[model samples]
Target: MSDANKKAIRTAIQTGIGVAAALPMIVAASGVPAALPWVAGALAVAGGVARVMALPVVQALLPSWLRTDSSASRR
Candidate 1:
């Protein structure tokens, strides 16, 4: 697969995993009901954001918050 496609897929997977992990905390902190669908909804939102950010133009224009060194090219 092309690198762009790979990147997008990777981003989506990571976002889903992250949202899943945070599902409990987000619900608890927000005092929202701990219904199962809330977790699914959060993951959907995160996935959509990741998809938007996966666009080449958006990726190019946005500085990655997790970057340790901004000087070099990212993997």
Candidate 2:
């Protein structure tokens, strides 16, 4: 696989793990009826953003300044 594909997969897995970890807290907060819409909207937007960030095209287009390369930082 190409580097872009690997990066995309890594991004997706990281996002999935994050969403999984946050699921219980999100579920607990859903008990508030008035806050349900906002919670759902936030989840939808977050999911959309995660999905977008995982795309190869987006990965390639991302500015280098935003990247956090640990090896580079250590130098």
Evaluate all candidate structures by whole-model CA lDDT and list the values in order: 0.66, 0.65
Question: Which digits, one per residue and each the tens of the lDDT, describe model 2 over residues 1-75?
Answer: 999999999999878757855754776776654357776676666667667766655655655564344333333
Cα error of candidate 2 at position 50, Å: 20
Residue-level lDDT tens digits of model 1 in 1-75: 999999999899877757765655777798776566866677566667666656665555556774334442253
Candidate 1 residue-wise lDDT at 8: 100
Cα misplacement distance, residue 27 of candidate 2 (Å): 0.3
Each model's TM-score, in the order given? 0.46, 0.41
Off by over 4 Å in 2: 32-75
Question: Best-fitting candidate, measured by lDDT?
Answer: 1
- Please list all clashing residue pairs in model 1, or write none if there are none: none
Q: Best TM-score goes to which candidate? A: 1
Candidate 1 overall Cα lDDT vs. reference?
0.66
